[model samples]
Target: MKMDYVSSGIGKTDFLQLRKLYPLFVFSRVSWENRLDHLYIEYEFWTGKNSRNALFFRPSLKVYGRPIEKGSAEWLDPFLFQLGLIELISYWKATCSPEILIQAGSLAASQIKWWQKLYLKGLGEFFFRNGIERDYPGILHIECDSAKQFRPVEIFSLQGNLIPVGGGKDSFLTLEWMKEEKENNLCFLLNPIKAQWDTLRYFSYPLDQVIVVERQIDSLLLGLNKKGFLNGHTPFSALLAFLGTMLMALYKIKNYVASQESSANHPTVPSESINHQYSKSYEFERDFQKFLADSLCPSFSYFSLLRPLSEIQIARLISEIPGALSVFQSCNKNRHCGGWCGHCAKCLFSFLIFRPFVEAQKISGIFGSDLLEKQSLFSLFLSLCGKAEQRPFECLGTEEESLAAASLLWHKAKATGKKPPVLIEKLFSQYPHLLMTRNAIQATYDLVNTEHSLPKKFLSLLQKNVIKKALFDD
Candidate 1:
């Protein structure tokens, strides 16, 4: 018999928890943003009235059949050294759609199904919405089935530990928390970096010894171009699973710790995405946790360390902790010449969130630029302060933050020449017109003068917390 079909487009997601949405179609005019060529994606899944052994998959996506230079962003001369966004795009297309355009086996897109969605919605609202700074709306149209199609994933306990790392907030907080709990004897994964470990140095993590996984997907990527195999999102979970398997095969430590922030629970909005943010949702976390358990040999565990903190809270923690803000760079697309390259949305949000703790001058210095020249940045940021047509999981702060940053910008504009930063001058031109910006400044100042609510969240997850005791009991 043919498989029963269930699918949908994800609309304004309930931040943190994974709720179900059917018939979801995420459409975006990305070319307007000058980011890429215009394209769209559609995702579908199936779960029948009966079938315990249901298959998890993504329908194939056939995008960019030609060169990106020919209006296919796929071929736009790659980032200075980075690899491919198409790898992610193609992965999403094939795994959810019925088509089989790409041959990159199961990545994280498997969670774009029904079982995962319901599971997360069942959990209390302990999730983060989309945190990327994209101006796209998620329109997931859900199609439900009454019969059972839940393919339970087996959890494998392992004898090995996986330490996920990058040069950013999640890994830094995770490593610190783990070490404080005396779980220093875990494994570490580094994706063939050109520099020394980024987050590890932040907390002065003791390094008597540890397990490490270094991937070499670069040449494999270029070589696989003729057919142009698109790799879905990093099987970050799978990578950890393989680490657990390696531990079983080698050292035998199954405690793999994923440093993904709780904020990652906020899904990403894809331009032309028919469905959005499937991999990072809470449902994915829970189901994949089980999938790893079921598929692995035995004794493996993967869990996010920052499940309790918001992005702002996470940023607050990073600031209080030394060395984190000083050396991390999180942008993927940029024309920057120095540090943090404050052009990408990541850098902009990081600076905005840090407004309370660090002065603007210090932040610009850290990112290796002065605010005097970032006219377009202030424009994009000011836009967020106003009401959004679709309130997404924006990385931008509230009215308080926008005003605080704007106050600083206004002061700087007083000294700036009458050029394109006219918006800067406009801030003070009519106070009532920029009500949101004004309110944001007042809120920011009030909060700052008050007890400061940012770092409190991290303090709960610190060394003294009772749950933390079990996390580091190595």
Candidate 2:
């Protein structure tokens, strides 16, 4: 299962070495079948002539509630093939092969271009972290020689919505806003963690109403990462988008509702195109909608319900919903631990945003400690507030949002006649000019970015929820 021959930490030299060693990576084939409890999907990949270089990945979706009638292969093959295409990114990163031969299914020239863009932008963080310099036209070459072109399914009328939940504050707010439509909504979780399950329970959504996808990454890829082939962040949300399409078709759901906010549009590295949240950006959302309309099912709808709002607004809204706030968890580092890690950027950002609205003691309790008080997080705070050279490679709000949140917290602490946290004091002392005015902070809380794909009904629901919470002064 492990390759001991692979070298470790050669940087760009290693990248060049891997590509030279493994010139061509092939998507050999894909196979799937419906078992008694779940739909099993598998993909085979290999590089070079040695059979020892082959890699296999198997990811499954657990079938719950009603038994899914197996649709025709013609109707199902495209979805499964597309899923494999996205799933291959994990394995492909191990050795940045120059050419990818797709023998499993054929893709049109335009489809090939789409996948290329996804891979390039999706792997932006990967390339930057590994210090690999790659240009668009010269980076990768994807060729599909398979003569079989899977036909797109024309869906007539699919009802209700499929909401993907990650047990985060954004999705938690989305679930609360859609509570009236609970019966019509099908909640989805990929590899559910304890926090995710607890979030559903808090919302009173039973298991039968949830779609659980159990994805297993091949151990070979992990082994390669340890051997230092090449590894970093991939566009996981992109994979989720493809998987969402499959779920919609199988369950006959009309809309694919996600919880990505407008803040995701900001690039992690300023003055460049590299974004850690590229897949969740509005650009990706817009392109995906068009891809669905032109290439895939035209009737299906996909959009993030919270796209219009900023992270500050989401935090403020969640502060109003006490029960939902109690169960939500956003710390990626501590996701498996079912609590905040209190050290990562995600934890610090969550704490900074919620501190202005939630009671100080309660916020501290939720995160297990006051994150701003930790001197160890000062560097992360600077990066988040635009003081550092680059932002932390995480899904975070824009620099302006971070400053606004910090300003609000600082002003609140001053108003309450309490000592400000260590990080807050350091931030203000170092960069007093970055402090936001009251009017500016209020505008951020009330503002809504117009670049979203939400239909009128979804927009109406979002506005209604904002009004109901009454977080802002009207």
Candidate 3:
């Protein structure tokens, strides 16, 4: 089943008692899958010694019918332990349980501070959304008992990259840029969807190159959520980062490349730090890299390939790629429909961001309608353009980026002596100064803030392989 399946559950008061009674959350054992073609993982979480919750997370990889390598038990143990920690972190978000107890797994003293920062800062938006005040002391605490000392694992040196596809344009751009290395590259997804499959098919790789992992959240958490537990957003990108670390130890893959763009660095709110994409931000990425090097295996590298590119640039680059126009779907609400719902912030933002690059008809074709033409969506357009006070809590570019795209398109239409699109015309009328006047749009497009942890070795290769050479024009 798809991960986004929503079920109707009894809504009750926020279960404040559960948090008060069970102040500690524990990371327990991992049930490793030794099956022929499955990479199954089951993790256990505990509120106390007796109260427990367990969930199954599996990403099935066929490995092209190859036999399992021998003598992996020793090195794989620590990786599995860390994977269990990552899984436990997400489950802990359900209740915001103050103390995280790792009875067996160990982290360095400094590493503990790093994990604490991730949990608190990453959950800032969650706290804000649930109206849960975080002004109390001892709210985010972690206890780690060293089970084993850290030891360096031998690098896999497989001459391959492991790319996690998220069924979005950003990942598609990353996949396209890395196409030359496709012979040595592998793709994986947690809970494979049609858009992901369509992207994989577009690349025409051997079926064995793709790995699918099904991540199942425990029903107990959902039941508790239904019972009105403190339910809100968790930093899923951080969870993905941990999963990548686990896969590196298991498969010995050299690089874990994700597709988080630089735009994610912007907060969901203008002046505050509450961001829905906190895990995808450069701060979290840098911190994760440091923790990985100091605590986990240094032989493996994790980084985002699209770190330097803005959302506008990414949208433009994706437009140049073939086949993704119809296959790609980033709308979280319209997943069952297999494309844009035309009603949510994601759909509106994506439609607006791509207008300057992709043809109007083709963009409309992808979404089944011209989103700019929808008058009912004017309020959402206002919010996306920063005219409204509340920014939509979704993975969108900054207000300036959206406004710049709208302005650039308006000028482009005027240059051709054609009337602007409905949304563009409306936005131009209200915020005329927001439009890019006298090459200002070019400046924003060229402003690639250098706040990323991309390795120096891959920089030149990324510049050369990107769909648009202008990606490096800055």
TM-score: model 1 vs. ground truth:
0.51
Compared with the true structure, what per-residue lDDT tens digits does model 2 show for residues 346-366? Answer: 999989988888877889998
lDDT agreement with native, every candidate:
0.39, 0.83, 0.73
The window of 10 residues in a row where model 1 has the poorest summed lDDT is 76-85
lDDT of 1 at 97: 21
Candidate 1 wrong stretches, greater than 4 Å: 1-161, 194-196, 202-208, 218-250, 267-277, 297-299, 334-338, 371-373, 382-474
Error of 3 at 323 (Å): 2.8
Best by lDDT: 2
Which of the two candidates, 1 or 2, achieves a greater TM-score against the reference?
A: 2
Error of 2 at 353 (Å): 0.2
Query: For every model shown, what is its TM-score relative to the native structure?
Result: 0.51, 0.94, 0.90
Superposing all C-alpha atoms, what RMSD in Å does each candidate have to the true structure?
15.6, 3.2, 4.7
The collision pairs in model 3 are 58-214, 59-213, 60-212
Better of 2 and 3 by lDDT: 2
What's model 1's lDDT at 238?
35
Give the Cα error of residue 471 in candidate 3, in Å: 13
